[model samples]
Target: MKLRQLASECDEGPCPTVWTIDEDAEHVLVQGFKVEDEEALATMKMPEHETTVRTPMALLKRVAREHLT
Candidate 1:
């Protein structure tokens, strides 16, 4: 997706928030924001990471299987 479109969808929650993405001719930039306690923020600066995972549907299936009888 376009960078602006991706960035606009970010929101605050129990998870990290995506802030913005700047797409360049050679590379794409990813930015994010997160809420944290003062101590955590002081030590870590921003609690964002460069990681990815499977879709929520796949995650849900895994969780359900783990808890199933």
Candidate 2:
């Protein structure tokens, strides 16, 4: 349960890998995962305020921005 910054670059939908977005849909949680695997694990979620990512990084960097707060 951590906040992960996404790369500005994306390959579009049906990508080989997938990102796990938060409940707010405002940020990424982890890098990428196989599509099949992602669905199976999507049931688990972290409480909003308690969410945290190890090796902390900035979430507002322009390289990867999440505007949905």
Who wins the TM-score comparison? 1
Off by over 4 Å in 1: 1-22, 25-33, 45-69
Clashing pairs for model 2 are 2-52, 2-53
Q: Which segments of candidate 2 are over 4 A away from where they belong?
A: 1-5, 8-27, 31-51, 56-69
Question: What is the TM-score of each predicted model, taking all chains together?
Answer: 0.23, 0.19
lDDT of 2 by residue, 2-66 (tens): 43335423456532222445555654444333234334345545444543222224422433455
Residue 11 in candidate 2, Cα distance off native in Å: 14
- Per-residue lDDT value at 41 in model 1: 60
C-alpha lDDT of all candidate models, in order: 0.38, 0.39
The weakest ten consecutive residues by lDDT in model 2 span 51-60
Model 1 vs. true fold: TM: 0.23
Query: Which structure among the candidates has the greatest lDDT?
Result: 2
**Candidate 1 on 1-69: residue-level lDDT in tens?**
455322222255433222224545444333334334566566655535633322334434433454333
